[model samples]
Structure formats: C-alpha cells, structure tokens
Target: MRKKGFTLIELIISMAIIAILAAILVPNISSYIKKANNEKAKDIAAIVFSNSMRSYMKDGKFQREDVLNNINEDLNIKDNEVDVASLYDSEITVDFKVSKLEYEVKIDGEQSRYDFKQK
Candidate 1:
C-alpha cells in the first residue's frame, strides 16, 4: 500500500541538485555574456575602421567627425542584438596615420586597439 508520489527526502535531494546546478551555471553564463559583449565591441570597432578607410579612400581625406558619427550610427542600429553603446565607458578614439589607421574601443574599462595598414 505505498503511494506513488515522491518522498520528502527525494524532493529535498532534487532541490539540492537544482541549486548546485544553478550555482555552477550562473557564473559561467555571465562570463560568457561578458566575453560575447567584448567580442561584439571588437567587431564594431573593426567595422568602424574599415568604413573610415573606405571613406578616406573615396574622399581622399580622413574626417574624425565623420568617423565618430559612423561609430554612433553603427552602435545605435536597431538590428544589433545588444546595446553595445551602453557598454562603452567613453568615446571611441581614432588615429589616422600616413600609412595606417589605428582605433581604440573601450568596453568595461578595457581598451581594445586595432591597426590597419594601407596597401
């Protein structure tokens, strides 16, 4: 004459297992999110660099204001999965060189730099 429901001990064990799994997964999930954001920032920065270079080639001059505007536009686009602009700590910096283009993207207080050499 035994019941078909789970015992109290079984329920407690299941709850404990769920809690342990959550503890293990939560931090990993957050870290992955941070990493993904960082990567997204990097991609945005690269695109900015590429667009600036193309504009420079087309116009025969590099405009800092235009580059900044492009950065804003790219980050604010509605198609983006994440609001990358919010993650940035400060305005992006672009440095134009005679034979190279350099840009820095700051996210979460870390700076990621990229260099593009002219061919």
Candidate 2:
C-alpha cells in the first residue's frame, strides 16, 4: 500500500513552482516598494511646505535655515536624510530635497519641479 504522504517528485515539483512564482513576483514587489518610499519622501516635503507657511504667518518672513530648523525640531526630520535650499517667499525658487526626491514649490505656482534621482 502507498503511504498517504507526498512523494519525493511531488515535493520537488511544489518547490520548483514556488521558486518560479517568487522569481516572477520579487521584482514587481520591489518596484512597488520603491514607489511607496518615493511617495513617503514627497509627503515629508509637503510637511515642510506647511511648516514654512506656518512660520511665515507667525514671523511675517520665510527663511530657509529657520524653516529647515523648525522641521528638524518640531517634525523631527532626520538631518542626514534631508537638505533645504532657497525655500522662502522672498526667494525666486524653493528647493527642498528629501531622500532622492527633489521638489520646487514656487510662489507664482509656476516653474515647479518634482523629480527623483540618486543623491
């Protein structure tokens, strides 16, 4: 009588199927994870924008260093992962980069850019 259990060939076939599925799914999952990370970085940049607006309301001025410092303090933005540049109303352009995503929030609502690159 045959044992009521998987045969060696059956076990090997199941493992092969699992490996093939993994090989097909891994790259798609990886791509999705990278997209999610990029979106999270953009969310942080939006937080920076809100903080800048709040600071402007309070101080009647917008300064790059001050806003960046507030983000570091109030929002606990990681210093090593983010950098700020020329992000004030008085400035012609606002540039803030978090992780690999760069955003330019323009006062005139024109000439803004959001792009990803290795940093």
Best by lDDT: 2
Off by over 4 Å in 1: 64-119
| Model 1 / residue 25 / CA error / Å | 1.1
lDDT string for model 2 (1-119, tens) is: 87698999999999999999999999999899888877876676566666666555665666666767777776675675555555446442345565455655443212233333334
Error of 2 at 6 (Å): 6.0
Worst-scoring 10-residue span by lDDT in model 1: 81-90
What TM-score quantifies how close candidate 1 is to the native fold?
0.55
Candidate 1: residue 64 Cα off by (Å) = 6.1
Give the lDDT of residue 108 in candidate 1.
21
Task: Count backbone overlaps in model 1.
Answer: 0
Model 2 scores worst on lDDT over the 10 consecutive residues at: 108-117
- Per-candidate clashes come to 0, 0
